[model samples]
Target: MKSELQVFQDYIRGRELRRTPERERILQEVFEIHGHFDVDGLYLQLRQKGVKVSKASIYRALPLFIDCGLVREVDFSEGHWHYEHIYGHSHHNHLRCLGCGDIREFENPALDHLEEQLAREYGYHIKGHHLQVEGYCPGCRQAGAFPAESNFLAKDSNDQ
Candidate 1:
């Protein structure tokens, strides 16, 4: 399989934009991270690498990359958005912690089966799905670190 960077390079080559150095740097950064990152984070990293591109350039390139099916936007439920590369990899859901903002990736065959069953029962053909589960992590729960009480949903009422 072609790497994400190769895929992105081919995409830009076919687009109106040629393979400029700035575009190459942006695509490289996106491929290196391979995880959810806000534009600011990506900009800082690019700057550190001596890429003098402006934040606006990074922002503009991101949408174009997404439109070209190079990257994907992921919302992990922390009121913050992130992006990840989508180089034709297998699909998986995310498990995010509301306490420490940690994101864990998981693939559950049982959940996939359940979704298929539900879709069939509803007389609908399953096309795609995105599942994100947010909760306190094990350490957070053990420490009784609830998420601002407003969003706490611990089964143990006395957890707090």
Candidate 2:
């Protein structure tokens, strides 16, 4: 298996695009992240780590990163792109905290069987799926707003 940087470098070379150290550094930073991240958050993280890459450079390299299968874009209708590593990870679902914009990854093998059954029933071949369950985290949920008896609907910030 080729290293992600090597794969990306080869892709750029094959496309006749020049490779730069800045882009490679951006890829290095991105590949290191094990959690979901957006362009703004990644830019700040790199800067805080004393890396000198600009936000524009990170944004530009993201497409190439996605193209080379090093990253994937996840959307939850948040009006921006969130990315995570896909090169060496298995399929997973997301639990997104709507209040803090936090994301947690989880996987259930049973989903594969369920997906297969659904595919067969629909007479379609399953390629892939991205599932995001959005809700307020415990910290974001207002105390006493949602009683234990009716906890299915937790009062989020907007309900206040």
Candidate 3:
């Protein structure tokens, strides 16, 4: 029942790394994000928030935070990894909007049960899994959002 920061301190202690204000600041900045975020996006966010934290520091702390179970890395098939802080929260899945890059979180006990059943039938131990469904969100569809083509293509069509 230790706090997330306490758990992180324990993790760093086991690794023989000294606790620093930089790691603590990075952890605080990360906890401020309520949704999925990428490394660069997080770095930029911290900078914009006047946190005085360096990108290298954030990048270095992310793996440790993940190992400490404070952040969970998620993949939405966008060629990069997104992370969510899962400490003090239950696990969930994602629904990503292909048109606008919006992401929604969801959870279902049925899906969890199905995963367990499938793993049991295959005689494999389930460590963890990630599910990301992609489609146009309601807002995108309402706005007629579509993936933009190349600038050349747009120019050619406009010249017609």
lDDT of each: 0.81, 0.84, 0.85
The per-candidate count of clashes, in order, stands at: 0, 0, 0
In candidate 1, the residue pairs with backbone N, CA or C atoms under 3 Å apart (3 or more residues apart, or in different chains) clash, namely: none
**Local accuracy of candidate 3 as per-residue lDDT tens digits, 101-125:** 8888899898889889989899988
Which residue runs of candidate 1 sit more than 4 Å off their true CA positions?
Answer: 13-19, 118-125, 147-154, 157-160
Error of 3 at 141 (Å): 3.2
Task: Give the per-residue lDDT of model 2 (tens digit) for 1-160.
Answer: 8898889889999999999999998888888887888999999989999988878888889998988888999996789988998987889998988777677889988888889999999998998787889776787665423224355456444556
- Judging by TM-score, tell me the better candidate of 1 and 2: 1
Clashing pairs in 2: none
Which ranges in model 2 have alpha carbons more than 4 Å from their true place?
Answer: 138-160
lDDT of 1 by residue, 1-160 (tens): 7776777777877875767778778888888886778888999998898889998888878887887777878987657668887767777899988878779999999988998898989988887688899878988878877645555564556675
